[model samples]
Target: MIRILLFSGLFTVIITAVQLSLNYQKETEELQTISQQLAETNAPSLARALWELNATKANDIGIYLMRIGLFKSITIKNENGDTMVFLGEKDIEAHQTSIKLQFEYSGRTGTVGTFEYQIVTDIVKRKIKDDFIIILISQFIKTFFVSIFILFIIHKLVIRHLNEISNWLNNFKPESSFSPLALEADKGSSNEMVKLKSAISEMGQQVHKHSTGLEKVVAERTAELEKLAYTDSLTGVTNRGAFLQAANEELNRSRRLSYDVGVMMLDLDHFKAINDTYGHDAGDKVLKQVSQAMANCLRKEDTLGRIGGEEFAVITPGADKRGMHKLASRLQQAIAILNFSFLPDNKNITVSIGYTKVSNDEDFKAALKRADEHLYTAKASGRNTFITDKGFLPRIVS
Candidate 1:
């Protein structure tokens, strides 16, 4: 706004300066015309005085011309180059004009002398200076008020609303909900500001919608990654890490409650030979089927996991020595009855089991180690059998 006012003031100054220059030229020309008229008006009387050799009359005429204030000086010279009259100061810079003083005698006219005058410039300069001051003051006042009015109108109609829009954009957030943008000044008006508000509102909605969809996609991907981390890919059962974590939790719960938790380890007898003969794909299929069978035989409180190649573990909460033996026997029977078309008729699936009851306040790793030792013992004694901390069970031939 200040800039607008300055430019308007400068423009007014330039225009006024131009007008003053023209007025100066016009006033100078009018002075010249007045000087010419004075010379012509006094020429005849001056000429009669010079022809009659009357110096007094010419001097009187010159003095009257000087008193008029238009001429800086007046001088009359006779035809023989004699100065008859001189009045006032001679100003070399002033505008000068000369007229021939002619006197008519009978049928002849003769040039008697020269009438000359210099127009005073001081008077012209004074008038122009007065005019310049008046014009400059009036123009400056008019421009100042006009510039202020324009600035006010622009601020009310445009700049204030633009400030609101700027603030809204600065505070916008895609994750949080926000009220729609509106301008109170332009409420129902269908001007450009209203259109801008509508466009920004629409863009904000799209950003929020996309942000929500992105969050959902990220959540689903995270869940999938968690499943992959905790679950065995081939058997669809808890993997070794998940199993150990769950067993540890169970052990802690049993310690608190003063109850027994059965730990069991099972290894498929001669499982690698099946992989060598039928290929890894058949072995994977067997592992999947056997783990599923074991899961089916367990109670709701049991957790089955594939801890190693052809090796599985189970956590059975609230199970005593008798319950441990019973679950081991069930797992053995479930595996022996399974048949695979890809296997030789003479080859039957069998599992050797080792079982133990967790002692009070025993760590899960120690119980798991004890169960693994028992599994090794059962495998050494004979295949297709269950061994407990006490001794091996009677063989159940399949």
Candidate 2:
């Protein structure tokens, strides 16, 4: 648009200049031809011709020159350089000498023989200057409106839509809700925008899908790590650290509520003999079977874990001395019934169990120490029986 306006303005100026120049050229040519024609006539003809330029005819020609937008001054001077009759005036004062009109005539260069004249004016120059001003003002107004309209259309249709697209792309994030924006109404009316919108929609979907997949992978890995931290690698039962942590929490709860907490410490019967008789693999199987049997017999709230080599602990909250004894007997029975093929010839294995009940005045480690002693007693008495302090509640004689 700007280019077109510039070219149009330049073309207007060039045409105006050409028209003015042609007008000047035509006037110059007319003056030259009139001078040559007068020169072609004889001196007698020249005199007769000069007689025709009388006062009435000169006045008529002056009016004609004014009407035709010609020169402002016309005068004739003889070969002696003396000014004769002026077209628009009678004569110049001696102090105000006029410019001579020197035209060839009668095979001589005398200017109308003391009566020749020429016409000159500043009128045509002023008219051309005025015409140029008018043309420039008119063309400028036209060009201004054309430029504004063209720029307005471009901004509304193209620049605004492109800016929207650029902003959407800049702020988009993979974790955010990335639904593609609805294309502008004007954009939707076009097929190119529709295609662009579809592509952006697909990209958003792919980003959402990839984000979901990444989240799932992270969650699964976290779960696996948690299991490894809490569970025994060989038997899939709670490890020593996990069991102690849980038992401490349960003990704290029982203390707060004035309830009893029971802990059982058990060990496999003749575990070293089994590992020596068969192999470490068979010993591992026996441990797994015993752990599984104890787990099956216990409630979900009860905790069981492998605390050491062939040694295990079980915790029962809200259980008294009698309840702890009964639970120990059940665990012993469960271990006796476990069908383990850990021996050299697929022989069975049993476990000895011992348990302690926490009293109001005793700490958890003290109770655990008592349970360890009881476990030793059970192991010494028989490989498959359980032991507990028979007088734990009856002998509270304080």
Best by TM-score: 1
lDDT against the true structure, each candidate: 0.85, 0.69
Estimate the overall C-alpha local distance difference test score of candidate 1: 0.85
lDDT tens readout by residue for model 1, 28-62: 88888877887788888888999899999999988
Off by over 4 Å in 2: 1-195, 342-347, 393-398
Error of 1 at 342 (Å): 9.3
How many clashes in each structure? 0, 10
Every model's TM-score: 0.63, 0.59
Give the Cα RMSD of candidate 1. 6.8
Instruction: Provide the lowest-lDDT 10-residue window in model 1.
Output: 389-398
Model 2, range 1-398, lDDT digits (tens) per residue? 66867887787778767877787667566654544344333233333334454445434443544354333344543445544435554334311223323345566754444433343424445666787788778767886787678777766666665667777778777778766756655642445655676678688779878997888898998988889999999889999889888988888888788888888889888889888987898888888888888899898889988989999999898887666766777787877767654343455667787787877777777888898898899899976877787766432223
